[model samples]
Each structure stands twice: as C-alpha cells, then as structure tokens.
Target: MNQRVLAERARRAIPGGVNSGQRNVPGLSDLVIAHAEGARFRDADGKEYLDFHAAFGPPLLGHNDPDVNAAVAEAGNGADLCGVGVTEGEVELAETLAELVPSVERVLLTSTGSEATFHALRVARAATGRRLVVKFQGCYHGWHDSVSLNVISSAEKVGGRDPISTGILPEVLEATLVLPFNSSQAVRQAFADHGADIAAVIVEPVPHNVGCLLPEQEFLRTLREECTKAGSVLVFDEVITGFRHHLGGWQAISGVTPDLTTMGKAIANGYPVGALGGRADLMDLFSSRPGGPAFFAGTYNGHPAVVAAALATLRKLRAEPVHAHVFALGERIRSGLTEVFDSLGIPALVTGYGSVFVGYFMTGPARTYDDLLRNDANMFIGYRRRLLDHGIFELPLNLKRSHVSYAHTDADVDRLLEAAAVAARQAGGEVQDLAAASTMGGAVR
Candidate 1:
C-alpha cells in the first residue's frame, strides 16, 4: 500500500498514526518508510532520500551497518533470551563501557535511554537519601515525570515548571528544580537554597535536545563542584552524545566527570540498548541481594543480539576512523550551510558539534534556550520540509537536529549543501544583506 493508505490504517490501529509523538510531523506525518540502508531510505512509494535524521541520532555508524547486523545475526543463531542467567556478551559489553567511559567504574544495561535515565535518578535518590532533583531547561532526560518538565517550554514558562505532558502529579513536578542552560549563577543559587535536599543534578553535558546548546565550561565545572560539595550525584545524561562524540563520552572532552552517566543512542549503532554507569559505590546500589534498597530488573536488559550489536558497534568505533570521518562530514555540512545562508544574505545560525547540526533561523551565538526563542519557527520548519521535497530527509520540526552518519560521504555533504541553498532561498523569502542587517542589530554567527 502507499503512504496514505498505510497512514490511515496506522491511525486506526495506533494512537496518532505513529508510535512516537515526535514522528507525527505536520507536513511529513504520512511518511511511510519501507527500508533503509547506508545514508538513505526509500519510502513506500519507492522514492529514495538521503537520511540526515538518522532516526534521531542512533545510527552513528549508519542504518543497518554490516558489522553490527552480522553480529546480531550470529548471536541470534546461538541465543535469543535466557532470562535466568547472565551471558558472556552482557559481561563483555559492561566491561567495554567501564573501560571507555571515564566515570563508569560499574554499569547496568537497559533497553532504552528513558529506562537508563529513570534508573539513574532512582539510584541517585537512594545514594543520597534526598528527594529533590535538578535539571536544566531544554535538557530532556526522558518521558519520566521527574525530569520531563521544562523542556521546550514557551517564553512565558521557560523558567517555570512547564510540564510536557499532563497527568504528572504536582508533587512530582515540584520535586524537579528547572534552571536555565549556561547560567552558573542560577545553578549556584539553586544549590545554595536546596543543597541538602537535592539528590542529583542531571544535565546533558551538551543540551543537544534543543539542537546543540553548547554548555559553558564554567557552568559544567560549577555543577561538578557543587554536587561534590553537597554530596549529591552528578549525572550526565549522555544518551545522545555518548558514543557519537567520543569513545570516552563528552566527559572526557570536558574534563569535568560526573558521579553517574546515562548513555544510549549511538552505543549500539541503531540496536535497542542503553546503559547507566558510574562510580562503583553509586552503581552498586542496584545489586539486588537481600536488603538492597534499589531495585533493578529487566527480562531483556542484555538480550544476546542487542549486546552483540553493541559490541560490534563499539569494536568498529575502536578500530576504525568513524569519529574522524563523521566529524569531518559534520564540519563540512555546518560550514557549507553557513556559507549558503551567508551568501543568500539570510540571517541564520548553523550550530552543532561532532556529527550533529541544526540550522536555526535566527541570529548567532545560541548559548541557551532563551536565545533559541528568537528563531523563526516557520522558516525552520519550511526549510526542512523543502529539503524533504528535494530528496533530502531532515525531520521537519523546529529545533530538531540533523545527523551525519558514517555511511555518508563527502559527496552526500555536497548534495546537502546544494539542496540547502535552494531550500534556504525558498523558505527564507526576500533576504537582506547580513552586513546591513547586523547594523540594525539583527545579525549573529
């Protein structure tokens, strides 16, 4: 069946014609993907498009990677799910995580990023015997009630408890203290007021959820120092940045290690796997022997096939120049797009790090979520939708980032730049020279 018919059937069977709410885009909501391979996917109508969405950044090595697929197939031949005992693959994967991540002395496997975050928070609370948690605005931990509030809030609700979804209890909402990104003062103040009661301060070292809000070094340092002083768990939610940026994760790059780290996304190269790892003392809380207060159990926590895929993905990352290649492609796309918009005399900020990029239709220097509020939502959405029309797939939603996968080539980068020029002109109507616009206080880089 075509996309329209499939969409109708899905809407009847599924809640909103999609399993995830974010997949239900405005113009491209009916997208029915048939199959995907290296750097590209074909729709049900058999039209192929270069995929920069990368299924929201899980496909760092690219879609259906050969090594990962082979490992999965090999593991499937031997084991499916022996729920009672641990497998060799599970032990190896955990060891690999502890070896790679700077802060991870011990690790626990989970099936999804959300689960990793949930368990991390649970452990943090148990470790400190504290009830409150702190998270930054625009940093999404998961759909769980404790860390779900204050993400993607309106200007009016940016600094307040803007619940993303209803049904989260008021007390749960009150337990989370939301602060602005890049604001060390706010963090210090929060800690000063509620230091004794705060269990953890969870942050995405880089708030990529809002399309790459680079964390200020001082801000990250403050979090580490305060959490250390207060004896609270400092959790880095590296679900999006873990394996994608570096084998050691962003903590290695920043040199400010947290007590606990929650990782997923690129770890398994598109397979279903996530992990929470940290200092042995904190992680050992999950050891459910006798009177262990923390409870951690999952039937499919380390499914053989998933662990195989993760091991294969990590092996490729260790041996190959995967990071170098994707990082180069990412720089190429960011620079190329910046030049495209600059030449067109359109005010835009193409911001990202490593293999990620987001083209915000606004002035430059996007340091926080508030800075992103100036972004023109229509132009941002229009540009992505236009690129989709021209056989390039970026999720046509505001603040959603595009990825550069290992499967993408320099030629793919060129193709994206060429298409972006056209899409920019189409979406960014009647642009003025950036020089002139800057004089009027309307320019940034």
Candidate 2:
C-alpha cells in the first residue's frame, strides 16, 4: 500500500525482514524511516512522528546533526584512511573523552558496543588470568556469547539449564553466574565462592534492559569493594548510558570509576562508534609486546570519519550546554507522565535518571529480574499503539526503556504528554497488576 509496505514485502525475501533488530520497535510496527532531523523522523509512509526513542539512545545531538555530519564529511574528503594509525580526530576524541572521564588515561576505539564488551572481557581475563565472568541478570552487554546469557531471561526459562535462546550454545551460559541486580548479598556470596577464579564483574551501570532499573542499597559500592579485594576487574558497559547520563557518562554521574568501561551510541552522534577505556595498566594488555595480548582490532576499528564525527559531537556537547536542556526536558517528561498516570489511575510509573527513562508500570520500584517479569506488558502494548496514533513515537512495546534527546523541544514534550493522556485513557484510566500477563511469556516472565 505504501513504501514501508513495499519495503517490508521486498525485505522478507531476505533474512530478518530488517537488517538488524535495532530497527524493530516493539509495540508499534514502525515503517521504514525515510529521513530524520532534530527530534522528528518521517517514515516511508509519509508520517512525521516526534522521535523519543532517539535512535535507540544514541542521537544525543539528534538525527543527522549538522556539526557531526560536517565533521564526518570533511574527514571523508581527506583520504578515506581506514587503518590503525594515529589520526588527528582519533587523538582529539580520546583526549576529549579523557578530559570528561578522568579515569581514562588510554582509550581503544571499536566499531560497535559488542566489540568493546568482547575486548574488555579479554583484557580482564588476560590481566587477571581468571576464566569466569560474573554478570547480573537482565543486563545486556552485547549479543556476544559470554555476555548474552541471563539477559532478559526469566527466573524459570534459564534457572537451571534450559536453552534461553535458540542459537546460543549451552556452553556459553555455563561459566557465567547470573546474579540479581542491586543485591549486595549476591555479590559477596559470589565473590566468596569464586573470588580467585573470576576475571571481572561486567554490568550496565543502569539496567535499561527490562525498563529503567537504577542502582540502590550500596549495590555498586559492594561490587567495587569486593572486586578490589578479590583481584577481579570491574567493567561498566556504558554503551547505552555513555554521554546520555552526562558528558562523562555513568561513571561521572554515579561517582564510581569502573576499572574498565565500554562506551558507544551517542559518542559519534548516531554514527557507529564504540570505545573501551580504563586504568592505564589494564588497557596496556592490548600491547603487541610479548607480555601483553592482541585481542581488540578491526578494519574500521578507528575509521577516521567516524572518529571525526565523535570528536565533533564531543566538542559540541562541551561547547553548548545542551545537557541542561535535556535534563529539564527529562524532568518535565517524567513528572508529566507520572501526573498523567496518577490522574488517569493507570498502574504505571516513570523510572529514570537525567535524559533516559522508562514507563515501567507495576507496584513499587522494580529491583529484580523477577520484578520486571511481573510488570504490566498488555497495558504498554495498547498504550504504545495509541501514542503512535497520536504521532508521538517512543518505544511502544514494554521495551523497559524510554529515551529523550538534546533536540526534543518544548512542543515535542507537550505532544508526548498529550499522547500519554490518550494512551492512559485507553489503559482503563489506572494502573493494575500485570503479573498475570507477565507469566505468559518465557522471556519476560
């Protein structure tokens, strides 16, 4: 019927109907986006929707930001140099990031978040000579085999030993001990049991996997202390949280300097760029000399143009106080949504920090994977559709995360609030227990 219809029809002839699952918006069957600028994108169907998803949390400067685009274009004009040599853009980007994140004395750039996470693990393992990796449930480091286990899996599906995913081999989940988030007790117990053999404790500084789950109860403190005592490296996967939480990302916002941190997304203003940086001694594990190992390298690992885009993006972020605008917008969005939920009596709450948030509908604060499994999904499903109908495009499905960008305007905020009003009206005007629906799907349950 339309370009999106034709595109989907044509793409089904291929594999995933879409290139990567990143384009998949859960609740709403989004059409192919034709063009995006600022906080709006026009789909192939010619519908202009306000984009709250913000390219899945990158696009902090909004889509096709002129500054980043200009930098990328200028760099491309130079020599199409795609090698592992020191480029001006790369050096500037590294220095800028180091200035923002004081703990990063050295940095290694990668193509995507997965590559950074994968390399971080290798560095940790090589540095400590430990084989096991400890991870918390519901935290997604990447699609990598080692970090894929326990991510979005319920207490039932992956509790003992059933395959949680179709393609992941069983061996991948064996050594990974999935512990609950925000539980100091679990961390201590895990450390006591396998302290000597564990390589690192990798985590999403804020678990946006199953909604916006934040840290509490000295959970981060325990991890820091235990890893310091146990000779295990502490890695923070700031791929999503990087540059969004603050210019310094989660470590700066949380006041916790992870031994190693993986960052991506907003660093390059929606261009593909991921980086891993940490303590100087640990990053040296990638040296070509005899003592160190060489695990992190790719053809486009430090592509000049992308590095230039990142450099420009970082420069703009520093020069302009846009984060203040985003912080104000985030507070308004969160407050507005909470008030609407209250007035409509919908069983929902907005959980978040700074510019990132999630419309988590449930009782009290969601603290565990089991708790996320118990939140309302049906309501969010219906609500997502209504919001789309109103032309406010946030994640429709219960994606466990909502996002805002530096480009989101006051008008956009008003539109989002109006859309939430419509969605809430359809949600029976009040919050209700979604535990029953949560039990149906093995993934979230």
Candidate 3:
C-alpha cells in the first residue's frame, strides 16, 4: 500500500483510521509501516527504523522471533482452529503462570489488557459486594470509565486529577476515587474516608502509562495491609509488567500477591491475549451464565493461535532467565543514556525496573503523578521527534518511562545513547549543540 495513500484513505473513513490512538501522532500518521522483522522495520515510505516501541514492550524477544513466528505459522496451518475446546495450550499456559505467580489459583483469558482489568474489578465487587473503587492518579486501566480519572493530570494542575476523557458520563467518574500514586499516606486517607464503601483499590504497581512512575518501597505493603484491614480487595494491574519484569510479574518481585491480577501484552508474545486470575474466591467472576459476576463473553477472547503462542512464550521464559539478561542490559542502557545527557550538560535522569527505563531530562526518581507531570514535556516532545528522525520509535503517550527489551543488544544500547546525544542537541531551549545543529539544518540556529 502507498504510505501516503493508505494514511489519507484511513483518515477519510476510518474514524481516526488507525487501530490505536498512539498511531495517530502527527509524524507517525504521515508514515505507514508495511512489514517488520527482528528489531527493525520500514515505513510505507521505506525508511527503516530501530523499533524502540516494540509493540509497547510485548515484542520482548523482538518482532518475529523464529520460534514465535513458527508457532503462529503452525497454528495457522492446523492447530486447534476450533477456537474453543479441551486444548492443552490453554491449560499449559495457565499452569505456567500459576506456578510462576503464587497468587494465581485460577485463570481466564481475554483479548486485551483492558478486559482483564475490567473483569478484575467486577470480580472484586462481586466478591466484596462494595461499589466504590479506588485508583491512583496517572495510572491508566484501559478506557473503562470507573478508572479513567487522573490519567493526564500534570503536577501543576490545580486539583491532583482531572478525568482524561469527556464522553465518559460523570456518574461513572463518581465511583472512582483518585489517590496519588506512591503515597501510602494518601491511600490510607482514602481508606479512612471511604474504606467501608470501597470494594477494591485497583492500581498499576508501577505506573508506566505516563512515563514509568515507581511506587515508594513501603507503598505496596501499605496498600496490601490497608486493603486487608478495610476488607477491600487489592488488585494489581500487571498488564504491562506481567512476565516482563519476572516470571510472576510484580507480585513475585514485590512478594505481595494481590486479590486479583490482570495480565496482558507480553502474555501471548504480542498476540491478543489477556487474563484476570488470582484468589479462587475472587475468581467467581467466570462463573457459569446467570451466576458469574456479570457478562464476560466474547467470540475471540481466547483464540487458539494466541494460546499456543502464549504456551510457547511461557515455555521459553520459564526455561530461560530472561530477567537476568534484561537487568544487565537495562543497566548498560540507562548508564549509557544518563552519561549522554550529563555530558551534554542537560537536566535529565533515567529510572525504571528490569528492561524498562526512561531518559527524562527533567528529574530523578520520579515516584508520583506530580513527579512525572512536573517533568519537561517540551523537551520530551522535541527529543521524541529527533529520535524518530534518527531511527528510534517511542510512543508519544505522556513520555513516561521507555523500555530496554531482551532483544536489545550492546550495539542497540550504544546507538540509543548516541541517539540521545544527537537529540539533546536538538532541544529547543538552551541546548548548546542544538543551536549549531538547528542552524545547519536551516532551522532557527
């Protein structure tokens, strides 16, 4: 397809004409990618890129790993095309996760992360019979209205959080209580104020949607303890972190098994697979028709291709110490990029866990909505465009934290830092080299 023709055609009839909102970025919409392989791909215009986005981190082994591709190819050939039946793939994948995450007693798969988070809340309310749901500011739990508040709140904003979208009815926002992430004090305050009425407190243990905002050391423990004391279910939205940071996701690393855990993204090696599983009592959400928590049915929620891919992915992950490699590579990438910014005399810091870290030319140890929001968005956007031009692709979603995937080699890390140095010179304000580079490019020198 002609890149310009495809994009123009999409805009004509496709209601944004793209699968996800992030694809509609000003520069990205102008370039449509045709095929991807390994760690690189070409746009419709055939400009090759070092794919840093990597499908937002699910392409951990890199795009089109031979094994993953083979699995897909074989499934497409003839492997449980029925889409529903007593297939060993689903059971094997579930077993792998159960063995990996102690909290998971039973598992149900879905097509995307949103569904997993959605049903987890349903399970919580059904199990606890409470209506109120507590979520932190800046954490995104899909598009569902109950958890939409505080997604885009900047640090300087008057109130800590403002509902990110408009179509969501105000009544839905009423059920959501927004608390500052990484603040055990605020969580406690909410519990004291609305604990009795709240059925569950859902959160991304590490909020990566708006740059990666890690919680304080005692925050997770406090969340668990308070939720327990108040008789409310604690849900960990592990869609992005699941199986990426470790075998069991945040629950394993933190040693705090939530009442409910949602898994997606990497769960099926980029295939459309998600799951909500935890304590058996809390899993009654999947009960038989008319008896379950509510409606949880969809035709392709648990497709066989995705299930097989997940089984293959988990088998490999379980056999290999992926996190160990990721940790080592992450340190190199973070250190390399940190040095780049520092050498340029720019104000930036890199922070995150495992293979995920971000270069923020703003602050260090970002831990809350306030911390991430207060960062330099202007510089961030400028750097993003520069990186894309220099062949690195990152989602424009709040410029939170970025990732260092398993596929990233030492060369990849080196190039990333090199790219950072190049982009730093393009910063619109006070960047010494940026002035010279801009002038040379016929921009405002």
Candidate 4:
C-alpha cells in the first residue's frame, strides 16, 4: 500500500499518525520504511535510497551490521529479561564504557536517553542539595520538564525560556535557566544570579540538535570552571556525540570533562540503551542500599541482547578506523555540498564536525539559534525534498543534520554530491551577495 493509506491507518490508532511528533516532517509526505540494512533502506514503495540519516546517529557502522546482529542473536538466545538478576553482557558493556569514556568511572544503565538525562539531573539535585538547573538555549537534553525549554524556537524568541510543549509546569520552567549558547557572558550572568541554587548545568558538548553548533573552547572551559567554583554538577549530554564524534565522546576532543555524562545514540549501535555515568562519588547516589538516597531502577536497563550489541559495536569501533573513515566522508559531503550550492549561486552555509554534517540556506555560519534565523528554512526544506525526489534519503522535512556512517563508501559520497548538485540547481535562485546584503546586517562567509 501507499504511504498515504498506511498513514491513514496509523492515524486511526496513533495520535498525529506518528509515535513522535517529529517522526515525519511538518509538511512533507509520510516516509514509511519496509526494511533497512547497511548504509541504505527500502521504503514501503520499494524505492531504495542511500541512507544518511543513519537512524538519527546510532548506526555508525551502518544498519544491521553483521557483527552486531550476530552478537544480538547470541545474547537474545540467552534470555529476554531475568527481572531480578544481572546479565554478563551488562557487566561487560559497563566495563567497556568505563574504559572508553574518560568521565565514566561508574555507570547506571537506562532504556532511553531521556531516562538517563532525567536520572542524571535527579542525581545532581541530590548531590548538590539544589533545585535549579542551567541548560543552554538550544542544547536539548531530552523531553523531561527540566530541559524542555527553549530548545526549539523561531528566530524571534530564540533565547527565552519558552517551553515547546504545554503540559510542563511553570515551576519546572522556572527551575531551568535558558541562556544563549556560546555566550560566556550569559553563562556568567546566570551563575551570578542563581549560582547558589543551581544543582547542575547540562549541555551537549556539541549542539547537534540545532543543526550542529560547535561550542567555543573557552565557552566550555568557562562552564567547567564556573561549575567547579559553584560546586554544581557539570553534566555533558553526549547522546548524539558519544561514539560518533569519538569513542570517548566530545569530551575527548575538547579536553573538558563533566562530572556526569549521559550518552545513548551510538552506544549499542542502534539498539535501545542509554547510560548515565561519571564521578564515583556522585554516581554513588544511585545505590539503593540502606544508606543511599537516590533510587534508580529500570527493568530493561541493560537488556542482554542490547548490551551484547553494544559490546560488539565498541569492539569494532576500537579495532577499526571508523572515525577516520566517517570523518572523511562527512568532510567530503560538507565541502562538496558547499561547493555545489556556491557554484549554483545559492546562499548556503555548511556546518558540522567529524561524522555529522548539515547545510543551511543562509549566507552566514550559524553559531547560535538567533544566527540560524537568517537561514531560509523554506528553501532548505525544498532542496531536501528535491533530493528525496532524486532518491536520496536525508533527515526528512526539517533541516536536521546528516549522519555519515562507516558503511557509506566513497561512491556514496560522490552520489550524494551529485544529487545535491541537482537539488541545488532545482532550488537555485539569484546569487545572494553578502557584500550587498551587509547593509541589512546579513553577513556571509
């Protein structure tokens, strides 16, 4: 059946015809996938496209990797969920994380990134005896009330504490201080006003959710230093940047460590898993013994099959040149697309690092959410639609960044660039001369 029929059927059972609101793009056609494997997936319509979404940054080795599948099968054969027990795979996976991630001395496994972040914040509150938490304007931790403010907004209210959803209590919104990302002055001001009551400061070391905004080195250092001085927990939400940016996460790349780190996306390849780990003293709050205060428990915290897949993924990542390979592909796509858009006289900017990349239909480099306002979202979405028509599966609908997997070959990159050229031409218009738009305060690079 067609996607329309499937979507109509889904709407009868599920709200908005989707499990998540953002599953399908706002004004785009429904994308129903039939099956996916290795660098590509076939949609319900039987059309196969080269997959750059990579299931939203989890499939670093690509979809359905043989080793990961084999490991999953082996672990699945062992048990599903022995409710009152622990699995050897969980132990091995935790050990691998402790060894790989610099900040992870102890780990508490959860089912999703949202759960990990929620518990991490709870641990922070318990450790510091504080109620308020600080998160940057566009750095998304998860859907939890503590972090559901100012993550996604239009250009006008980009820096305010605006909750995207309605059900979040005003008290919860008040507890979160949303500051402009990459602005140390704002960070200082927030701490200056509420440092005493601040329980934790959580951030995505690299803010990929807003189309890949890199944190200024000094900005991150300032966070580290200020949190140190205030005795507040510094939590790095590395769900998107964990293994994709590096095996040790962006902390390894930046040399700035957090007291607690929450990661999931690339942890178990593409399996359902999330981990909250950090300094032993702080993580000790999760101990449910006679003395411990914080209670953290989940039935499928570390499912055997998922942990087994994670273990296998970690082994392969350690043994292979995965980062080098994927980074090259990412850079190629970035530069190639930038060249394609530029040559076609389309005002565009490419931003990202390592294995993740995104293109904005704006003249200037996007540093903050406000800066991203200059982007032509309509044009960007139209361009991506043209690419989809050309049989290239990108992050559908929105201008979310693209994930380059180790399974993507040089030929894949070439084909993507080729498709991008066509898309750029189809979406092209009068060349935007930043030199001319400068009078209007539009800067270009």
Q: Rank the candidates by lDDT, best first.
A: 1, 4, 2, 3
Estimate, for each residue in 177-272, the C-alpha lDDT of model 3 and write its tens digit.
888888899889889989898999999988888767776669999999999999999999999888888878888888887988999987777888
Displacement of the residue 38 alpha carbon in candidate 2, Å: 0.5
Error of 1 at 442 (Å): 27
lDDT of each: 0.91, 0.80, 0.78, 0.86
Candidate 4 C-alpha error for residue 146, in Å: 1.2
lDDT of 1 by residue, 35-133 (tens): 999999999989999999999999999999999999999998897897877889999999999999999998889999999999999999999899999
The segments of candidate 2 whose C-alpha lies over 4 angstroms from its true place after superposition are 25-30, 158-164, 287-291, 429-445
Off by over 4 Å in 4: 429-445
Instruction: Compare the candidates by TM-score and give the number of the best one.
Output: 1
Q: List clashing residue pairs in candidate 2.
A: 27-397, 211-400, 344-429, 345-430, 345-431, 346-430, 346-431, 347-430, 347-431
RMSD vs true structure, all candidates: 4.2, 3.6, 3.4, 4.2
Cα error of candidate 2 at position 436, Å: 13
Query: What TM-score does prediction 4 earn?
Result: 0.94
For model 4 the local lDDT of residue 208 reads 87
User: Model 4 scores what on Cα lDDT?
Assistant: 0.86
TM per prediction: 0.96, 0.92, 0.92, 0.94
**lDDT for model 3:** 0.78
The lDDT of model 2 is 0.80
